[model samples]
Target chain A: GESVGLHLPTLSVQEGDNSIINCAYSNSASDYFIWYKQESGKGPQFIIDIRSNMDKRQGQRVTVLLNKTVKHLSLQIAATQPGDSAVYFCAERFNNAGNMLTFGGGTRLMVKP
Target chain B: GAGVSQSPSNKVTEKGKDVELRCDPISGHTALYWYRQRLGQGLEFLIYFQGNSAPDKSGLPSDRFSAERTGESVSTLTIQRTQQEDSAVYLCASSNRVGGNQPQHFGDGTRLSIL
Candidate 1:
């Protein structure tokens, strides 16, 4: 089994404030990374992604940053809202042979109003 | 455009029973994958299908677990002799291709409980 754990650190932000969730991956061969959001009773939904060739990618209200040097990935959400409350996951894909994604432990974001 | 869909949203069976979870990937998706997530845990890759190559069953917990995908469409994950530890949300995802920047689209997942 592949094990990719999170940083075990969470960020709590007030409503309307920006939030940043971080992740650490172990495999340096990982060539692709993605951010997913999972709400209660649902599977993970794609939020944004970054290829190993690039460092940053942004969406409507979300952004993903990858630092290859440190094998670190981060997701930033602007003006975080209650709807943003959920667990965030960062997955890494190493090599293209199988191209399977190994996911991180996940971070629970709490947006307090 | 329809997203990936899964079947039977929920299932409950006694220990030692067998259960099958299904996934219908988005049309035109050539790659499908199966994963499991225990309560409060992250996703665990189970298998991968690219066009027709051998399915990657490396992450499958044991021989009791197997999956099959017909053509480039629906996929089924079977768990035999279910145990209490088998209770979890079985997730399915599909991608446009095997490599590059394509994101894997996921279904809501099938929640399975072994009583």
Candidate 2:
């Protein structure tokens, strides 16, 4: 079965520093990818997303990079904050279907103040 | 309007008990989704509802899980005779219209703990 996965289970970074979270997906047919952040006991909050056609996209202080060849994706967060210390997940989607996004195993991001 | 809302922020039940999770998507949003997140695991897609079209339950893990949406408003997910492994946080999300840029607003989620 196809699955979306993360390269690392956890990442620790100093506050105000940059943080990068990586994800690898098995399905190449997915057209869209999204990054979400989840705090303790809270639902996932959308961060940023990029389509398959584009290699990179940025929003606010976050950027999403997609590599179709390697079926890999990454999220870059600028100026990590204590509030940003949470689990980050990457999701894949297609427009034709019901638009449900497949999620990757989350990577826990810890920001030390 | 609220972004998205879910009921019963937490639930604890016996292994043989059933559970129901509710979600109220943002006003006028036409898409709804249900997902489960276990500890140290990724989100598992359970069901998807988009407007008037037939829902997609392809991601449902077993027959114990079922969901339904009324018109374009609220949605409910039911789990029958849940086992201990069924315990997890159930998250709900809604998107404007199934677009690339529109973000899928998520609710706080319902944490289910099976004893």
Candidate 3:
């Protein structure tokens, strides 16, 4: 079965430091990927997205790197803040999957001041 | 420019009762999706509606779960004879169009608790 999964269940980072979260997906056919942040008691907020054609994509303070060869994806947050503490999820969508996103187990990011 | 909206931010009902969760997608969005988030877990895909096409219910857990959409505007997810395991946050999302590359915007979700 095709699945998306995270490399870590929890990642603790120091404030002002950079944080890296990793994900591994089994479906090589997946062409589009997205990273989302979910705060407590809130919905998953879109952070950034990348296409299989692109190896990296950058947002305001976040970046998503895709390694198609290893079926791996990672989200990097610069200057991690307390507000950045939340669960991060990676989702993949294949061209024939009818626009539905397949999400991986989330990685909980904890920022320490 | 309003985002996706879900009603009754929270709902608590007894086991075996039927509950309907509503989703009001963004204006002009042609795609709608429903997902379930268990405590300390990832989001589980439930169902989705794209334009007038038949909805994709493959993600529905069981026959007890069903969803309806009136055109592309509003969608309702109904769970009959809800069980304790059905407790979770039901999230709604919508995108401008139907395609793998289009990013979907989400709502806060309706927390359903089956007591």
Candidate 4:
């Protein structure tokens, strides 16, 4: 079945360093993608999103890069902080459908102070 | 000024008992969604509602699960004869009518524990 997946289940980084998390999706028809940060005991919080029309989008200190050719997406966080430590998930949405998201297994980000 | 709100942040029940979860979406948002997340997994789409259109329930795992949304406001998810496998965090989100292109605002989910 078509699905979205992440390359790593866990990523450890030192404070002040850059963090990059990768995802691979198999749905070619998906036109929208989003990155969400979920802290413990909380819901998934929207971080950034990108549409098929654009290859990259940036927000605050986060950037989302999309590669349709490779069916890949990446989220980059600059100067990682303890607050940034959480489970990050990448989700894809097929335009043909009425705004439904297919989510990928999360990547847990751990920042060492 | 408020975000989505959910009732009873945590629920614990024995097998065979039924449970109902509630969600209050952002005011004026017309799209609402329900998702389930098990331990160490991703969000599993359960159902979605957009305005007065028929809800898409294809993601529902079984007939035991059901949900209802009144107009564009509060929504409820009911699970009947709950089993241990039903233990998970139930999440609810809502977005502006613009669809997936717009980020969905999520509420802190309800944690369900079935023993």
Tell me the lDDT of model 1 at A71: 91
Q: Which ten residues in a row have the lowest lDDT in candidate 3 chain A?
A: A1-10
* Predicted candidate 3 versus true structure: per-residue lDDT over B60-91, tens digit per residue: 99999999999989999999999999998899
- Candidate 4 is graded, for docking, as acceptable
Per-residue C-alpha lDDT of model 1 across residues A1-113, encoded as one tens digit per residue:
21122333466799999998999998998888989988777778889888888989889999888899999998999999999988888999887655689998898887898
- lDDT (10s digit) by residue, model 2, range B17-74: 8899999999999999998877768888888898998898998999999999999999
User: Scored by Cα lDDT, where does model 4 land?
Assistant: 0.91
Candidate 4 stretches with Cα past 4 Å from truth are: A1-8, B98-100
lDDT for residue A39 in candidate 2, whole number 0-100: 75
Interface DockQ of each model = 0.49, 0.44, 0.46, 0.47
After TM-score superposition, the amount by which residue A74's alpha carbon in candidate 1 deviates from its true location, in angstroms, is: 0.9
C-alpha lDDT of residue A14 in model 1: 98
- For model 4, what is the alpha-carbon lDDT of residue B44? 96
Model 4, residue pairs in steric clash: none
Superior by DockQ: candidate 1 or candidate 2: 1
lDDT of 4 at A62: 93
Ranking by DockQ: 1, 4, 3, 2
User: Local error of candidate 3 at A38, Å?
Assistant: 0.3
TM-scores of the candidates in the order shown: 0.93, 0.91, 0.95, 0.95
Chain B TM, per prediction: 0.98, 0.95, 0.98, 0.97
Candidate 3 reaches a DockQ of: 0.46
